[model samples]
Target: MIGSPEHFHQLEKSLARKLGIAAFQSGLQVLRNDRGWRENEISIDYIWMVTIDHSYSGEGGIFAIKYKESKFREKVNPGELVQGIFTNKDEISQIYTETGTTDLRGIFDFNLFEGSQGITLDGVSYTIRISGQNIDTFISLSNPNTDSWKKWEAEIWALGNRMALASGNKEMINLFQ
Candidate 1:
């Protein structure tokens, strides 16, 4: 699940109350959206576009483009690939770092992964990863039981709070104190 920073915290609080657990009391983790790839270069093989809902065309929605090398495809891929969130198609055309055709096309929804599972409350954990000025968040659920969990958990919390403060998230800043 990916959403705005506010939505991330709100969902955390809601889940905590419903599950009777504090798994996500810590602030969400921050991740860099642009994976340090040079502009206009397809350094990675895979590009993923993330959306919260089925709506393909909209402003102020989160989209992610990730890089992963493909084993089968080795040919040069063409066209420009944008690497950040944009408020509108105009913004994408104006501020796009990559160079190529500047044509705006209809956005389409695609599934990177799909599955179904039964619900279980046992050993559940919620972890949020925010990227790009709180424009996107990736929430992960897992059951972790490791000796170093305590140490890393504290570190992650501190880092998350710092990121939230830097992003000017007033709610997260208040929670930090």
Candidate 2:
């Protein structure tokens, strides 16, 4: 039920707010909810953290896209909601921003590894995954092919290009190139 026109529209506005764009407009996208996963009843949601801005002192970084999915049963109306406001001090690490901790390393390979490296671009520190370039392969290997996966890959690619142009760090630029 995700990635309909309405969903993208919502994401665009969410991005604008996080990036501090009062009147922002661009052909920018963040992620796509893979259909195979979405169809699975157990698939609660997916979340991603993309850098929007960073601290001037370089102590930490800020993320604009705290992508999330909330489950709702059929015929349930969650109601309208305001956009989320995030800051560097806030706990933006995991989708579950809870205090409890559990050792999931042995449970899933996906959670065990730090797939992406953190980089600063336009004062925004993006967590770039080296394997994201091959996200297509990952999807194909793990799930059925779908347009949603293509969009997800494209969005990550676009994010890398944008990050490269805004970043002064050669190492960060090189990661994408």
Candidate 3:
């Protein structure tokens, strides 16, 4: 999914088409719900920090979609809301504006991961759980019975941050609010 921005765009387009415009629109709004600030004038800068380490093995990155309002407050974790991102284990890393301990080192598979709440990705099923918004975001695939489950923790992690947008139009307004 890296090296080709066009590919990601195409994938996004395909997903939008498959999921439908209304669902996608709702999803985007839901995605924006995680942010603390929102408005009709400001814009949001959603930056995805793509990285990796020894433990986790994926091309996933942290997303920092800024706010688009005059209000400057802390962001919250959206468990089931949010357009393009989710958190099953809200405890894995601090999100929005908390302690700023945004260093994640494990679990790189799905968008959301928690305790016992399983979601399938690339044929592998994972358990996702989140303590709450701006709380514990965790994902566990630990099951001695299966090989896939054993190496789940050190493969995926989802973290997010926020900033602020200064300008945009009506159509672009819906982007990173």
Candidate 4:
């Protein structure tokens, strides 16, 4: 899809709305410059963290999303797409790069092909992913009517519903609302 950043952002927001996620902002990048870390730009293809309402759990709850392009070094197919779920931002950040900051530390790791796609919190195992190899893949801001776009939307809705049910997070279930 060919579109401006703002248009892409709106598409993401629309997906969030479909999943009943109401409290979300555009994903942003923070880079260190001469003045320290500063906001850079919104992430186009990736949706960042989703905050669970406090009422859903005693402690704060959060989940993050990441889109990984297939890698040749690992023998991953170019057509394969991976979407990861993380318990915290730091975990996701590690896949991209270490932020060199101590503020985020709820750490865990996952490998798609190795079956390492889950985390244990309070002694409960939560499956943290839904992936496919070239399942009509891609969400383009400029091509909303493409087969890839429809497939992505369906998968997102299903995954969101499943996550919300498993986590007992009202916020996730009601995100779009």
Candidate 5:
């Protein structure tokens, strides 16, 4: 559904109230509260970052959530819509370019296709893991001539280390270093 300015505020209020109501009704506690979209801008269709108090235990705890509009509608049609999980991040990397294929090599094993588009997703495996709390990946590709993968792998690994820091996982920081 399209989000318009006039409807955003009401929507936000309704959502917050509902969330609050739901938490109370469900006997959940309120922990951290952050909203990606301001109450005034909820009309625009964009991703949202929300953190709340939750717990795997029946007690309670805190966690984060990132949600995007569902591409699935009344009828499920597979089109050019962005397909991904609700997550908190800058953006998900799309594998549309040969360059991306090359980069995936740093953390994946790719099977090259017999086509000109350089489609490398064919029978490939990506290796992204948290080793000692750091994100390390194993990658292999059918085409070994491209240089993009090696070039970006280190940077990505570094970013992964930073993410570990944000998560308060000290091991990740040391592992990448």
Candidate 6:
């Protein structure tokens, strides 16, 4: 049920309704960390900051793809893809122009934590942390629970793959496969 057509359809509908967008399938870009690191030190985990662009409006939302463990040194390998909502000031502009606000929690129904880092979707519990420059926010899964990570990753990949398929992006679809 993770990557099923029905699942993808529901996800598209939910995202479009939440983000106030007409369509979720548009342009997809997967960005990898190109920065260098020490030999012994582990570089930043393979985080694919996927940008989903709207075909007609050019507006889109950014989603961060992380892994349960850092396997590949540089390339993105097949593993648990932890999905996160990443939004900075610049990226916020691309997502919301009419609202003119960068507070995602205000726009979306995201439950905020007092001191801890996590989010509750439906009944599942997942960690969430917001960090970056002023007005820049990144909601990532930092929970120690791999099960939760796996489920979240599957949903995200399904959505990502569906978008890629709609846009006819073989490269993006290949990554998920």
**So what's the TM-score on candidate 4?**
0.25
lDDT of 4 at 159: 50
The digit string of per-residue lDDT tens for model 5 on 82-170 reads 11111111221111101011122133332333224455432212222111112322222232224555343344445444444554534
Clash numbers, per candidate: 0, 0, 31, 9, 8, 2
lDDT by residue (60-115, candidate 4, tens digit) is 12334342334333343232212322222212211111112221112322222232
- Ranking by lDDT, best first? 6, 1, 4, 2, 3, 5
Overall lDDT per candidate, in order of appearance: 0.32, 0.29, 0.28, 0.31, 0.26, 0.34
Who wins the lDDT comparison?
6
Q: Which tens-of-lDDT digit does each residue in 45-146 have in candidate 2? A: 212233322334221121122222333344232222112222222222211122112221111123222233333243323232111112311111122123
Q: Is candidate 2 or candidate 6 better by TM-score?
A: 6
lDDT comparing candidate 6 with the true structure: 0.34
lDDT of 3 by residue, 1-177 (tens): 232434334433333333222111111332222364442222232212222211232221232222233322454433221223221121112112222333232333433333344543432223333322233333333332333444443333313223212222221122223
What RMSD, rounded to one decimal, does every model reach? 17.7, 17.7, 16.7, 16.3, 18.5, 17.3
Better of 3 and 5 by lDDT: 3
Q: Candidate 2 lDDT (Cα, whole model)?
A: 0.29
TM, every model? 0.25, 0.24, 0.22, 0.25, 0.24, 0.26
**CA RMSD (A), model 4:** 16.3
Error of 4 at 81 (Å): 14
Candidate 3 vs candidate 6, lDDT winner: 6
lDDT of 6 by residue, 1-177 (tens): 322334334544444444433333322223233353322211222222333322222323334322233334464434333333322222232121121112222222333342334553332222222222223232433222344445544554465555545545444444333
For candidate 1, lDDT tens digit of each residue in 1-177?
Answer: 334545555543443333222333222212222574322323322222222211222321222233332222344434233332212221221111222232222222212143234443333343334333224436543332342443433443453344435546444344332
Candidate 4 lDDT score at position 5: 37
In model 2, the Cα lDDT at residue 117 comes to 39
